[model samples]
Target: MPKPATENLIEFLSNIPFFSEVTKSSLKHLTTVLERETFRKNKLVFEKGSVGEYMYIILSGSVKVHEKNHVFGHMHAGECFGEYALIDSNKRSASITTLEETHVLKIYREHFFQLISNDIGFSQGILSVLIKRHRNIDIIQENLASSKKALELANSKLSGLIDGAMDAIIMFDEKFRILLTNPSASVLFENNDVIQRNLLLFLDESSANRIQNLIKNDLNNDQPLSSNYLPDVIKVIGSHETETLNEGTISKWGDNVTSFYTLILRNIQDRLQAEDKIEFLTSQTEYLKEEIKELTSDHGIIAEDKSMKKVLQLVNKVASTNATVLINGETGTGKELVARAIHQLSDRKDKPLIRINCGAIPTNLIESELFGHEKGAFTGATATRKGRFLLADKGTIFLDEIGELPLELQPKLLRVIQEGEFDPVGSSETIKVDVRIIAATHRDLLQHVQDKKFREDLFYRLNVFPITVPPLRDRGNDICLIADHMIAEFSRELNRPINQLSKEDKAALINYNWPGNVRELQNLIERAIIISQNNSISWQSIIPQGGIEQEATTLQTSNTIYTAPELIEIEKANIERALKRTKWKISGENGAAKLLKLPPTTLASRIKALGIERPI
Candidate 1:
């Protein structure tokens, strides 16, 4: 028979470079200690979520490394894994499996732990593994970079330099094409993306002609054109590059020779009028628009309706004042979006805007959730943790569903809002924060105050500049406007090409009384887009509440407008279907209620009244 398989593996191991230098006595011991294990083709050596205790060294055959939605990469012989765990003792990042029958040196961490306890050199070897792997990565990166062309590297380096530079910078190529723009450069151009675009795009005909003439003159003189111009506020918020651009002429033509010049516009209103709010959009709701645009961007209302637009105007007016703003609106009216707009429009845009839904968090944990807790604060408090309020210091804290705050915790929140002081659980020290509060609620706080459930003092503090966002059903023409935007958004997100919504779907949208408001409308649109089999989204594709009953009645009575009360049954049915699809989960915000765009509280109410099972 062949020399034992273990002996053959021992012989193979002696030839590998990383361990080849070991003495014969050490090699024999290492061989004897390592258990030889065979994994057939496609056998799972380790999985992404398992707790690992062994460092595996591939001696024969290869394995694949795969990340979610990423390519399947390979690891060849002499490679090892379960290595990072040795350093931080964290969970595995990805799974590994053999492509063919494989053999590897399985070094159990327990055995290595014993070795480390007894020998200092063995400990050093384990530490050296991480150092060696890091060095190998550096070498591979350098080798790949060395093969890159000088021009490409120069361009990449220039981009990084521009982002870091205080002043804005813009570059143009010899053919008058836009080459690059830094963050500060965007701040100069009305905070818009003009980079990689034609130089002639942003300017009017007169300005373009004037620049053409000036550039032509500069080329004839073989000099650079220098002029002071008003920069757009949009550009300032966009890029933080250099304020001046230098474009040396390569080939200057006669009057307007084939040439490109880099022009730097300065935000003239920066110091004068405070153009921080210039980037605030008052068109369609940005949240819904961004959703349609496949961006997880915040929402805002730039209402033109005299009543609602006043909220926008007020938010802008007090935004720089750094005062607390309490916004009250119905469930789907975009309260958190307003909070974000306030933060962005304030001086603390660079800081976090931590948000918490007071109602969703259990009353027992609310104290620890908002004020943090020390290690051993309670049974599961194994480590010290920072709470939402502490994390939001120096920035803004948006408390959504503020009315749902527990009756007992209400006083502590009142103290924080009024005195800016809070104590972590089981800690004697009171932490003071320089935080701005922006609270929102769909419930009637005045009633809660009367019932002695809410603190009136806190209400008055946050109600400094009260803002009310209009419901989606009340936006008139903006409904169609938002729908078109959402269709485009969901199409891109789902990677589907839904060219347009069917007339029936459009009619249904307009007729349907969106009790959940804008949020509900957006969710329904997304659902239709995701389920649409064709390029066009139709009403039938939308699974409403009450199933066939709702669909038949809604389609039959398409001529009649749906009132909130009338569609109550239909909404209930749709909610049930959503819950079934999600296996009756109310866990993450992506559950049936969230997917339906209904407030979690509101969804819960319907769930109980309808006897829908709660999976928590």
Candidate 2:
């Protein structure tokens, strides 16, 4: 049927240009040795300069012939390539690739020669094809010569333009091998013989590879690249000066077949250095404020009374350790000052002491204030921020008015104090820190815990090492010491001559109940100093609501108002009243200090100063 497939193939072979006029019997023998093959679109039939051992005849579709990256010729069905292999072994002069799905008949070198020797017409046809190919090659050589001249002229102009450029310019190939460099580039590199050296040698591997890929992509896309800004420091090989804040751009140039890239670089070193100096100055200004605060605050706390002395002694012992401190006292009893004192005496004294008043921040913003937040964590959070706990890393954090902290957030606070780690608001990552905690509050935390207003677990965690600050009234003679210190400070500040306090003034201060503690005493002393025109401070100038009238009545009623024995007896009577009110418990919740509105330490000092002991 259909004259049998072999006979059909023989008939087809006899009609081809190489086998035309050969006897059908010889064509049939040739067909028997012919091997059939097929190739898809864009498939390589043979590469240039490869050893060719077989000639291929296209049976269907089309193929392209290319020399290097340039396409020069095309062939369709019934056309052959590697024809020189039939005569003698030789490398292919050009590469042949499929343009579309193609079927080919392959004739091995030995078999092709056998058929050519047996048929004179077949040999003539092979010679005719070879002659035509030689002529075509001559024409192609002429065209290539003309193109080479044009390319030379273009390269000359490009080189002249590059030499004139003030910015550093360099040309490189796809493999990142240097091709040419301008005078500016040579100076920047500190070397004249840079040709063939890889760019990776001059800069860091990552940056060099990035620049190479950037240039390669630009060349492939035939587009200009945006300038890439470098960091503060870039190391250069064989150069005395290191590059700073350098920027560069890459662009494609020259022939399409052999792509070449050019890079232009600019220096912004001076501008970057100026910006760095401004940043340093801003940080220094902030540091100066902290230093001034520390210097001034260190002088304010006095410990002349036995109660205050004991508190100071405990502070010294606790400052050497990383224990949590819970300072218990009235609002104006220098609780924060004591916290600062502990920080200043600790191992982490050089680091920052972050202070946050829990009562001062709004309820909604307290979480962000304590643990920081990422940008867009909530509305109005325009940028990422670091909280007080983060800023106090390797230092101390003073949580003032801790009793005012919201109960909902007490668990997080407790975790941070116990584990030294916390998650920021709206962030998944946990931040760990090395910090000492010092918390202060005037409210009764134990009572709040019992009332369910504060967390009991958090209260127990915070009360690890409690230190009570003494009130000014129960501090006894220390009141006069604090008065003189405040008067001297205010005199220097106000430029006044009020230096000494009268005996009646001192006695009136000792007898009157100080409702507002040390803060009130400091305020009174400052006012008296500001109003007085003379060198001496009078009792009339600083008399509380009824101090002068009461002093006069007491002086008329008693024989001696300034005697030490009578003053001790009066102090003992006051101590006895406070003890009776508290049921004689010395230092705990509902103790004498709570009843008398005094710090437990200050109340203890008053009992010792007055020589009053607990009755059996």
Candidate 3:
């Protein structure tokens, strides 16, 4: 018998997406036709191929929709089903089973038709449900087909990979029963039938026991295991040969119910043989490089400091590549030496390495020097000469003090760096050169970029692999090493017998903060060699009294410390002296700009900012 529906049922149905547009009056009549029903767990609500009678709307609990024994989907409260059965006379396409005690509102075919007749919205709702069901079914079918195709492709590739593999691949169940074996795995078993056989039958007793324990541990693990039991070497007994396997590992596979352990083995005999040959070749190459380095003065680089060692390591890495390298450090910090090391370690070692000091060249002659001028192109123009770029063709160009390069020349440099082509001074022909550029600068190029002095694009281009060489103060004991080398050279140059540094001499050298870096140390060592009568060098005689320690001592002894005004007074005096040397001329050759290595406009701005004026 069927129960009567309630007004609450019609109110709930009105909220459903399919029936939300229907009038309240129409929904109220629908409640009179819908009978509220309840079914117990494991009860069959409908069977496949059964006659179509009513559509069900779940009010509570859950229902399992399936075909045969295969479950397709489930419906909980607030969901509707079987609307398709009401419109057609065909049998039910899927059976509905209750998973738990469920409450439902059922509308029989005759009453459903009555509700539709009063309101056409009911008919459209039924049609909407039918269309949606068909579309969902199509999507599921398409996904199933696509998934099947993907699975087939993956399986085909896996089969090809296993068959073509040279490594032995064996898969066994938790019980150690061999489930499958590739051709490589089977070969080790003397072509015997391996499937369904005990894995211990083929492997050595010790190896088999170890592998058995590993598999048991993996099975007992509750968390997801990626892999386990990586063996350095595993000996496996084969028909013709006893195979020594390297990189052997046992990995987990499949699900918990039908879990498997896959054993993968690789033979590294050929790889080891090749590694030995490579090691021998590398040693011979290093020996030749060392011999060449011993013949040079700086040996390209000395890097005893940790920071400098890291810089050298980076240089070795980037040297192989064609990327532009920018070395940054304080003046006399061996930035140029680092650049030279990169070139020496590179493939361009056989070619010339033309050096250019941007700050050394006069502003007026810089363009002509970088891109050679034609004969008679400018005053005192010499015969046709190749520029630094042309001379460095098929090699490298070490651009020292790169931050001093003029703004006007930066674009041309950028063009040449990016395109490997440049136009010479007073010439239209574009000259191309394959030159590796290694630029070094003591100035903060980034600050220059902020001041609009250096091009940002050019900075990025040169900074592809930036290496910062540590200053001598940071190099600690490396100062002694550098001093020793300098002593030998200076002794040879001066015809002196200075061979060693005394304890006091070494302590003085180490104690001072080398503001002038390695160059200052070399100068001191050279002076010491010349003044010393005995074999040992004198520290106090050569070393200056106005270094970092002297400044500290002076400050400590003074009653009053100097302020900003005093420092400014000193700067003002220096500027005035430079002005006098150039006769108040701020630009052009022998002018204040050229003397200070500052642009004319920059010098003018500084003069205005500092309230500097020429003497009457």
* Candidate with best lDDT: 2
What is the clash count for each candidate, in the order shown? 31, 0, 0
lDDT of each: 0.67, 0.76, 0.75
Clashes by residue pair, model 2:
none
Give per-model TM-scores: 0.45, 0.51, 0.43
Worst lDDT run of 10 residues, candidate 1, spans: 275-284
Candidate 2 lDDT over residue span 1-616, tens digit each:
4698888787777667666656677667777788989999999989988898998888899999998668998999877778777777678889999999999999998887786787676666656756776888999999999989989999999888989887788788877788888998887787889999986577765667677667766666754454444433443444555553456766666665676777776655776778756754454456446445433233458877899999999999999999999999975678988999999999999988888768645689989988888889999999776777877789899998898799999999988988889999989999998889999988889999899999998988889899999777788877777777887888888889675776766777777667557765765676576556567656553455343322333443665444434544665798898888877765557777667765554564356445577676
Worst 10 residues of 2 by lDDT: 547-556
lDDT of 3 by residue, 154-192 (tens): 999999999889888888887889888898787666655
The number of clashing residue pairs in model 2 is 0
The order of the candidates by TM-score, greatest first, is: 2, 1, 3
TM-score of 2: 0.51
Quote the positional error of residue 424 for candidate 2 in Å.
2.5
